[model samples]
Target: MGTINELLVNIEQYRLLGYAAVFLLSFLESLAFVGTVVPGALFVVFAGSLAAKGFFDLGDLFWFAAAGAILGDGVSFRLGRRSTIYFSETNRLFKPSRLARGQEFFARYGGASVLFGRFNGLIRAVVPFVAGVAGMAAGRFYLWNVSGAVAWAASHLVAGYLLGTAWRTVEVWTTRFGALLAALVLVILGVYLLKRFFVRRGRLLLAFAGSLLGSVGEAIITNPDVRTFVAAHPRLCAFLAQRFDRQRFAGLPLTLLGVSFLYVLLLLGGVIEDLLASDPIVAVDTRLDNLLFAFREPTMVKLFLWVSQLGRGTIVVAVALTVCGILALWRRQRYILPFLVTLGGSTATALLGKVAFQRPRPAGVAVYREWSYSFPSGHAVIATALYGFVVYLLWRRTAQWGQRLNIFFAGLVLMLALGFSRLYLGVHFLSDVLGGYLLGLLWLIIGVSFAEWRRAEWGPVSAAVPFRSRAAGAVLLVGLLAFFIRTGMRALPAILPANGAAAATVTVPAAAIAEGLSRNRLPPYTESIAGDKQQPLSLVVAAGNEGALTAALRSGGWLPVEPVSFTTVARAAWQALGGGFPPVAPVAPAFWAGRPNDFGFARPLALAGGKPGREEARFWRTPLRTNGAAVYVGVAERIVGYEWGLFPRLGADLDRARDDLVRSLAGSGVVAVSRKIALSPPMTGETLAGTPFFSDGAAWFVEIRP
Candidate 1:
């Protein structure tokens, strides 16, 4: 590559001579023996790059390279036509076996091989020669040969030209602000157009990609060895055919059936591999978690929180019962079987997987907590099973392919959303969610297969009347409304436990208000709202109001952090990439009152060397008040970069932040009383990053002076 770049640089110095040089190089590159010794392809692309720089005309460069390639292949073809006399039978280049392979390739692809072979490295040299030896007509060779040469020339030249254009643009943007803006605008416009193009031709693009994959798959399936193995194991083939065929009852083709089964197996195998092996999937999951965490904001948090609740025990039960009742009343009673099998099977399987794998959840600061073992996320499992069954039922009743596709994708979106909710909430790892999805899908497939098989034997029954029956439809509508009501009504108390009557309603432990003080070396880590790992609820303020708490932290040299919105996140990411630690970095959410932290504050640390760190605290404004003062609960954590990777850890112990805060407050001459309070039952736990910690369940309570 370096040598090719140097060659291109030298060519740029000589204008007309450079075009001649490209023609010569491309000619030799296309010749039978000479092509193997020359780097013709790179030279052609380089010539194009130079043309883009305005050193030569792109059209002239293309025609010259293409003409060179044509002439080179013409020579190779004539050599092949006279091979018997020009070369010995023992000559390595004209060996019978090598010639036979080329003959076979030419036979398989026909004249089209002459055109397509130009793009392929080794084939470019041999195809023309072999075609001549195989008695291809001169007219036919010339037709494909010229066409292939033109295509090859145009492709490389255009690619190199575009790259050169981009390089020039970047060079200008470095010193010119206006040019930079222009470039950015162009990029945005290009992206918009590309997106529109894909959207308009999405089906065509998908079909093309699918066909390419299908071709490769067909080759593998039809291999002599594979055919022999299948022929010898007829039962195995039959079993796979039945398992994979979605429309087996309707006599779906064996190829389609096998493809469907293979796809499912691929997904299932991937999830299982991540669990059984310390695979790259784990790294991918962590990176995804970090990236998504970067996009945390109040709206998304609320949205996912609500969506995750759809898989909650109450909502799932209601939906399952409503759908089953409607089927039992207005349709065949046997239709209820799919609903039962999906829901029950998924739930049981997920539970068993949890016990069998015993995998722990990813440790992070979070807003929700679950006590169950976290191998396969129960939420992911339930959502896939329940919603998937709904899609199945909708598919059975719907006649239109478009409507069926819509229903299937909607269900898929919901299931994926629920699974993501588990990750965002910090209660499950990527593998766990993937495992749940696979497990749920497996169960749904089985249920649907059974339902389809039974229907095939008994003949199809009409179950489409539920849509026409207002009474049955009403049940589904009301059930859905109940789900909204349950989640909405439950949101505030869980998220925003504000002062006044609501404040008094919270169930604080009797010992919490005990008139005593307890001091431990370590404070108990607040249980993650999403309940993954434990971290210290390091600070509490008994201030006159929210404004007072804000003023106190600000006066103590802590800067208030912006809520995790898009702009703030982008800035933080940009700064982090440059090794600059933003003081107000985004905080992983921890829930109190079922709501995210109301505000975050951080102070930059000064280290003698190495990457700097930040001491950050996140606070929740509770509705509770003490002696006419508003109460705020806060957890503190520190951030430092990983030694090996770009991701930073939020589990850094900054216990000294407590002493520092005390000194800062005392330095301000603001007399405040400090009290130690127990926040949770005593236990030893780890952070999401696997940092082990033991806390005596203590939090600091500071009564601030006005």
Candidate 2:
């Protein structure tokens, strides 16, 4: 690596040296035998950083890196193809010892050894040489060798460019930079936690995302009114809709009979159903056959399939819910404590089952549908945790026992909605959803029971019981335990060190890893964000035009951000971050701006009659809906908790009284209707929702036309 770095540096010091040195160094480094002794990592990294700083062109370093790699591998290939006879029976120019070592590894691991060997320092170069001698084709050998070289070069070069070169510049802004980084991290974690907390409290963004995709399916089906206007366009209708007549139910009875038989075998026969290949509950045997038939018509099924992929499970959902709980706590919402209890119980129950089962998935399951490992369904458990706890959380808030009973029953419906989605998508089995519900219910029972018992011991939930001394003691104990572990690990160096006389080489002790790590991480400090940016940054603007706006707000220490994201992010980001849109100002006179429209005029005017607001007061009030999409309204007050619905337009009415309470927020003394407002925009893009999941990919993009 050092030698390679020098070669890169010399290329700029002298043009001829740059070209020649790069070519030769790359060839040797990537070559079969000579690459072993050649050193280049430090040189390439140093050159990469220098290039980033404008001392040399970054492209020069990249070319040298690539040229060196290509030439080296090409030479190795030639050597392998031509020198197989001489090398196999007897070694000449190369040491027989090195080739002897390579043959052993190659034979044991086969083709994979060629790829993985690029990282094994002791035998990387020699293994290729052995591959040559072992009759590997030049084309196949080059493929793996080149792939490894490109990845290897890109990794080091990128690292040097980002961490080494850039970190050096960032080192100067240590104080403020650390503060900003910490604050940003906290804000992100906060947002994530808040979203998760809200989700657990019944704000289902995942559901919304899924619903968006399903709307597409529902759209395609209803667009031409195939069900209604089929007679008008018979040919088009026949193609668009599944024409069901006598054959529509051709195998229906058989399917139900088979399903019943399978269920009986599963529950009563005591047979090992897995061995019998009886797995996965289907509503009917013909379901798969129908699915297959639909799949055969790729265009028709693509939209439905896309919806299922949209429901990709995210820990972010959980994290956001936690953050929401934190906000609820900060606001002292009555629902706060119960929300946390529900989430805590849900998480504990779900995770315990996942660990307990550790069940393997069915073969080709993921390939067919987006299937994760089976256990108690996360959806079911989380749902139960929230809704079951909701009953207790709202116990005292409700005025009547009937109302409580109504809410309890409603909560059950929600849990079913969540639990059923898991099975509807075929991601979980019947038992998985059922087990999840039981697990969640069981945990809920225990939590409620424990809380009931501890209520007297802990005092009222609203009362704050401060304990400074106990907190200090706990913090100190943790610090001491961490220190003890550090000392134990450090002491281990004296007892153990690699001892290998056969490989005559310098041995680095494991203890040295600690020192090396520290040196690598710690950089010289500075106090500026400008000098800190020795290399221009490739800013990743994730928030669309919002990033453009934020970049303008940045101090002179930074420049305009180079956006890397697409347009859709602006919509999502706007929603997630108290999202909003600029006022829809008119191009001309803007009549509504000067004079209130029916929306505003109707509100206050409605107060003039017998009812205070219903008459003239109607001129001042506007209706708002709680659509499932995330929303932010620049209203005079929060409508969710207050002014819930339009009521009798009277000063003495519930809405009018509640309006006085919520008209102001924590920061603002008076809330006013602001121009900027956020509404749950129609969803766009890929998500995990209604349909099914993927066989191989971690994420997927849903295709929908506006």
Candidate 3:
């Protein structure tokens, strides 16, 4: 087991080779027999740290990790399959505790355990061997195996690469950079994993009480009617406002649940501003005097005018908002998170736009307030986005259309109020408000689309982390990461660039920042049968569950073939990349091949009645026909997209075509798809790089078309 710091430094020194090493090491460690002895955590982080220095190819990471993983476990599985267990009785004498723990972890999390355990410190090696010994289905194992390896490799490498290059100072802040690096590794890995699981539930509700209670609370926050109603009901609004500062009121604990939401909101505002800061077209108007003079007659809102000037108020507001966010999380107010995500996404974008475009604000600007750079109004961006998200989280919970309508209208009212507040105060131009609204709403749309896209894939929420002594510490740590990382200057630039011009003028692009977050930030998908024709396709598969999803293809006459890892397929494809002849990777190769990786992952899928699509496999097809037979199997979110040469037919549906297949599986017999590849990047507009592919819970089996 290599220490993380050594890995990081080595990777930094060597660049891409380091990533390849990491990719190979992580995979083998996870797959190798009793290999959990390998230190996966530190290795991955160091790889990431090295990647951050800008020398690695992130795309190849999937294959590298996957290959390493398969090989590692291949040996273990081979050992278990070939070596009798009786001989292992004596092996226990030298069995390290870590190996035992790895076995225990495997037992605990199920097949997914092998996947997750590989990433969680010293457990990587032993679990895969144990899995191999259990004779776990190779396909399923590979699916998870590939996924785990990809995630592990990407996270550590990218983290180290991006943060290492961009914000290495954070490491310097402490004497023990290694310790800091380790802690950072844990946080980065943890946060990315969490984003995939329960958090992607398409914006859940805030249940301060139960894993279930906050469901409705979420509806309240995102619903426009609620916002409107609360706004209209000054008394109620005032009550909430008054209680906002209260951590606890009466018997009900107004705790950290709401705090997280607020924090996200604040970041969103600032982030949006940052996005908008660079664009000269996006800058806020600086002509303060004329703008303020017009508002003189409106005495009703004068008090807030002074508050806006202090900028201190904005800081306070930002703090309060962050506190609200933490409270929301602690309370299991899951619903708020979607809206928060939208807000965060938009604000960040807006800020990026503002700063990137460097669009100066309208000049001869208003005197009411000394304004900073702004193309779109942060107030406006947040108003439509954050409030809209709030409303979205609120209204979706109720079945009542009337309530939904009410909240929708109310959300509109609140948005208008905020928009009016900004305009009346002469703080933002009409265009600024509109641009903010447009951009902010765009974020909401994207967030909502993402939430909806991932809804089916979202699993049950994790049990909430209890707010204990560590809660504060955890928060402080996160804040330190966010703030210092943001503000943290690196010695890299100073060290590399000559003094005057090069250092100050050339800003390193964000894309230059290590893989730009996890390749798995998005969710994954299962096979979609929507486009499959009802033609009886001959499925050549081995027995067991292999026949379960074979549609009408019967195993009675089917030839038995040895199962292989998907990596075999990936390797073949990688090799075939040199060959121009494309391969139609079947949907759910395991359905036909017994193991998940046995045949073309999508090899078995075709219009059964028609001539075989691939000439190579045409000879294998029998004149078999099953009407309305369907097979659908479900898998987890993973990095499982077919590369272009692998699936030439996968045009618009590459990202979503798999889901279409899943839907088409109603009458199908067996659907043995892999949950692997949930963490890999998307190839095209067919899918974005950020999202992963997760399947619906079940792949409905029905006789359907390919």
Clashes (candidate 3): 194
Residue runs of model 1 more than 4 Å from their true location after superposition: 1-273, 283-295, 463-468, 491-564, 568-706
Q: What's the lDDT for residue 14 in model 3?
A: 69
Per-residue lDDT for 335 in model 1?
A: 62
Ten contiguous residues minimizing lDDT sum, candidate 2 = 585-594
Candidate with best TM-score: 1
Model 3 misplaced regions, further than 4 Å:
1-292, 301-340, 362-367, 459-706
Expressed as tens digits, the lDDT of each residue in 96-169 for candidate 1 is 55455566778889999988878866466778898888889999999999999989999999988876654543
> Which number leads on lDDT?
1
Q: Candidate 2, which segments miss by more than 4 Å at Cα?
A: 1-16, 84-94, 174-706
Worst lDDT window (10 residues) for model 3? Answer: 491-500
Task: Judge candidate 1 at residue 619 and give its lDDT.
Answer: 82
Candidate 3 structure quality by residue, lDDT tens digits, 201-295: 21221221243345666777779998888878989776665654433331132323345345545644653454445322222222222223222
In candidate 2 the C-alpha lDDT for residue 111 amounts to 63
Q: The CA-based lDDT of model 3 is what?
A: 0.44
Task: Write down the TM-score for model 2.
Answer: 0.25
